[model samples]
Target: MIWRVATLSFLLTLSYLCFQPVKMEDGKEESMELGTQSQSQMDTSDSQNKGSNEVEEKNPSVEKSGEMKPDKTESDSGSKPTNNEKSANKTPEENMVEEKKSEKTVELKFPTTLEGFGYKFDEDGKLGDIETGEPFVFKVRSHDDSYNQKRYEALGEVITEYVYELLEKEANLKRVHIPVDASEGEAQSFIFMTEDALTNPDKLLLLIHGSGVVRAGQWARRLIINDNLKSGTQLPFIKRAVDSGYGVIVFNTNENRIRQGDKFIPVRESSTAVDHGLYVWEEFVSKSAARNIAIVAHSYGGVVTVELAIEKEAEFKERVFAIALTDSVHSLSHQEVSSSVIKLFKRIAKNWVSSKEPLDTPVPSRHRYECPQVSAGTNKHEETSWSSFESIFEMLDKAYKEVTEIDKEEL
Candidate 1:
């Protein structure tokens, strides 16, 4: 009778343990709807729950400290936990926030140098295409001219340094700094020349650029920013001058300011455009022992050449065999060119003015008696130098040969 009672109690305890309710971590009991939920439905529900947990771990808020937040149930929003909360607790608002954070993290990095800027150049050095790093600030027109000028100057500074490096390395030019002012010994202007420039070769070619932010080895910074390096810079000109057995000197006429200690100050002797030209000519050009000289002047450089001629008339006429001016801004009355200088200009100089006509085609006269005008092929002012490059070289070569022949005959 005792054995039968013990067996019956043990069986009742086993049945109670098997049929007990499933208690969750939250202390709430969950009952499975076995009849309504199939095997596929149960599997799908588990997968959705696992996906929510993975998203919470992997997709942390980038805007925040990039840390994962603790899991929150429907109870956090002042609502009772539902059966569906087990699959996914994220609201529509939470999903949208995560999407926005991911979008905000994506950014494009702009390049610092021209080589890394992803621009393509053609054989003639024209800009074929741009893949990246085009600053949009330049495209938008501003009402303020001064503001635009400042921006362009800043951009030109970077390009100027790059061109200076190219001049030293690629063109094999030496940079020489000359003190312009006795008071400010540290503040000086610089020029680039061949090794034989000071030694005075048989033939010398002097390149002078326009006014503005253009430096020694640059024709136009605008073209460099918008076009290609070849069209904008003076590397091609320097190379041609070297290959033709002529010593080259490129003037940094526009670089009038030098950084002294803590502040930027104007070079004493080269404070103005004309003054700079005068100082360089007296210090370098006049001092050189070159037999025959040639000048290639562009824009305000034409003004400088005229000033040099006026100041040193006898020397200019005797030494300078050729003068090629591209869109020269020289004024006979404004710059006070003398009758003697006018005669010299007519004898050896030719102005390649920007025009729609073909290259070397005669254009209308500008003054009573300045150098004769010919079409530069391009109507653009900035492109005049590069467009007339070939014609100018041909004129220089012909003049050089003729002058040398005349000297030989005299001897």
Candidate 2:
């Protein structure tokens, strides 16, 4: 009977142990289900909070929950967050803020039209109507007899009209008028040159206008006519240079008025003026195939032209055959002349040093002068003088003759 009782006790204990394991397994499954439900609730709460924040940013101060008190009162009350209350919590707006700081900076490249590069000319490479072949003309003159305020105003009106007409008529050449301060005065100018003039030898001739003549619409018109005629009196120097197998282009310097002392007008440095001219020249060059260039500048343009030559001498020397300056105020420097002596000796020392070497070893020399090649002329009157147009013409003619002679000798 004792043995049987002991066996029964052992079986009972073993059966209880087995049943305990099943009960523990069922409890673990229930715990896992509770954890999963908790996680799902948290995820749904986060989504709802994000949506609420977005709405608050748009509307500001809209209640998200019916039971919630005012934000300021809830902050002061120090209430503990319940499980449901925790679900409504919103992330700080500062954390949600999109910084929007650009990590990749974009560089802008300007647009270039076929006409923008100076390609507006025809087979002859002239600035005329493409359909009719008739050269564009302008009435570029002062408003009245005097070079006073009224005269300048009238001049400005004419210029405006001419520019409008040119843009309206020419589909090939695009013109942009960069305006300075209108309140100060009428400071505006335009650029006109064939896009292919720099690269195409058939289209060579970069024309840069000097101070007063730059704004005169007649200057560009005359230049165009001269270019078309190829033997006209308007730009005889340009025609001569072109005939000698050189390309031409033109730029308008910043200073447009002829008045001697205008405080309002800004005085540009020689370097700045030259750079502006060159900037336009390079634009034409980038689009064309012609390499050889001859720059023809008049008066103040002379200074601008020389600056460009000096600045781009190494590059231009191989390509630019010659530069013609007409009645220019600026002086030229010799290759041998040092910067220290340039101010005192001017062109004389520079010329002497350049010519000194070639004199002793000449084999039937073609160039007659021993000096650095420069053709300069001056009218007897002061810069402010309104002299006879004939005297100006004579000075220009003599200067042209000297330049051609130099070119012939050098070539």
Best by lDDT: 1
How well does each candidate superpose onto the true structure, as a TM-score? 0.67, 0.36
- The whole-model lDDT of each prediction reads 0.67, 0.35
Best by TM-score: 1
Off by over 4 Å in 2: 1-149, 156-190, 198-203, 216-247, 255-272, 333-411
lDDT of 2 by residue, 1-411 (tens): 465334434432322222121112212111111210110110000000000011111212222333344445345346865433553464444222211111013221221332321224455646443454544322111121121222223333343344434433442233444332234444444454433444464325555544432331223322232243221112344334344454444455543332445544433221234555666655554355664455555444555555555555555544444444333334433222234333322321111111112222222212332223321111110111111123333433454455557668999
- Local distance difference test, candidate 1: 0.67
In model 1, the runs with Cα more than 4 Å from the true position are 1-137, 140-153, 180-185
lDDT of 2 at 244: 49
lDDT by residue for model 1 over 249-347, one digit each (tens)? 998877788887888888766766567778877888888888899999887788778878877888888899999998776665545567888888888
| Each model's backbone clash number | 0, 18
Residue 62 lDDT in model 1?
30
